[model samples]
Target: MATIAHHPATGAEPAALRLGAGLMALAGVAFIGYAVIFFVRNFTGGFLELGIGPNEVDVGRAQVLAFSPELFRYMSHLHIALSGFIASTGLATAALAWFGVRHGLWWAYVTAIVVPVLALIIALPAHYPYHLATVGHLGLIYVATGIFVAGALVALKPMLQARHT
Candidate 1:
């Protein structure tokens, strides 16, 4: 007799994969929330998060444009956009990886690797200690993304090697 799957929802894998994905999603959501908070808090201010100094110094005073205002504006937008993208990117891949591993999708491993890798490449580098207070905040994003990637590999290694062709 064929052994019945402990979790018919996934297949034969245990509940750990689902939990890991869920945790990753939660972390993503949290990062987005914090980014939003940062954006709002610094809207009237500036990109002091990137070590830019003196909140709201008038332009053309005596400084040598330490950071281009226009460039900072563009970078600020890019940062926000990247935050939102990273927040949502892993949403489906993570869930798919979790359930797919159990369901024998074989592609789950690829999804798991690709999702966080993309996020790391884009978001991790931006996680430098921008402001004095935000060093910890930047650290959080990097560390969280790192954990997600590492956890996915450790938790989903079995199915990433599965033949998908």
Candidate 2:
């Protein structure tokens, strides 16, 4: 028989942490939704075309298309793999935020913010000068990243206080 350790309700967490956790959860669901859209839409047209209008092409899109068939195929695979990674990371961040909201765990606060920022960072190299073009201005990637960071900042106080205790 296994016993589950219960953590008493830590009382109402600071509003900031609650807000952060809520944002984290929102970001996670958004990521998962983005992944579904990405998979359904199928970014078979190379990287820059990802999350952007299919007819919208720019210099970067042209360059990516100039690659050899094998290279282009490889890049497409990379894009798909990245999508999966982002979805998984978002899900993990959201789940952890719940714990952070309840207990103010330092790691949860950090991860909630870091994961989305990391996703943005990951896009930097791959998307390059066309980062914004690759993923639309209103895309979930941009929106969720902002939300996660904002939420983390909002909750920073409690997280910091918890660290010293």
Candidate 3:
């Protein structure tokens, strides 16, 4: 007779990890969506119309000239890179958290908590120039990201406690 051995890490996943996985997945999707929007707005002829509009202070202020090949190229690359980073991070966090590894748990927790903070800081500087558009965009993106992060953090609490003990 053969018996199956139980493995703690590979057992039925914990509820926290499950929830964290879902949230991270959602965040990843959101980041991808944002990235696509950014790409459409900047790279193609879509231009400021889709975003803050050409006449917006950020555009008119001459911070970065619209239609400048260099500027658009830079923005395009930046948005694409950000999208890739966020989506990959979210997916990785979800998978690792699901596996219940200590390092994965910690990574999920850190990514959840840190990304939004950094994003908020970056968004703040744009507020003076972009005003409502900047605030609204930043609020929407970071808030959603924060929610996912909060969920990850909550799920990781047990792991966190284990470390302290």
Local distance difference test, each candidate: 0.52, 0.65, 0.55
Instruction: Give the root-mean-square deviation of each candidate in angstroms.
Output: 6.4, 5.9, 6.4
In model 1, pairs of residues that clash are 49-130
- Backbone clash count, each prediction separately: 1, 0, 0
Winner on TM-score between 1 and 3 is 3
- Model 3 over residues 1-165: C-alpha lDDT tens digits? 211122478765446555665675566566556656755665555544233654453462134554575876676677667666655554554445444332334654565556555665775576566454554455556756786666666566555554565
RMSD (CA, Å), candidate 2 to true, equals: 5.9
- Global Cα lDDT for candidate 1: 0.52
TM-score of each: 0.54, 0.67, 0.59
Candidate 3 global CA lDDT score: 0.55
Best-first order by TM-score? 2, 3, 1
Q: Write the per-residue lDDT of candidate 2 for residues 83-108, one digit (tens) a residue.
A: 69868977888888776643577666
Rank all candidate structures by their lDDT, best first, as comma-separated numbers.
2, 3, 1
**Candidate 1: tens digits of C-alpha lDDT, residues 14-54:** 45554455555555455556556555534544433333345
TM-score of 3: 0.59
**TM-score, cand. 2 vs. native:** 0.67
Q: Which number leads on TM-score?
A: 2
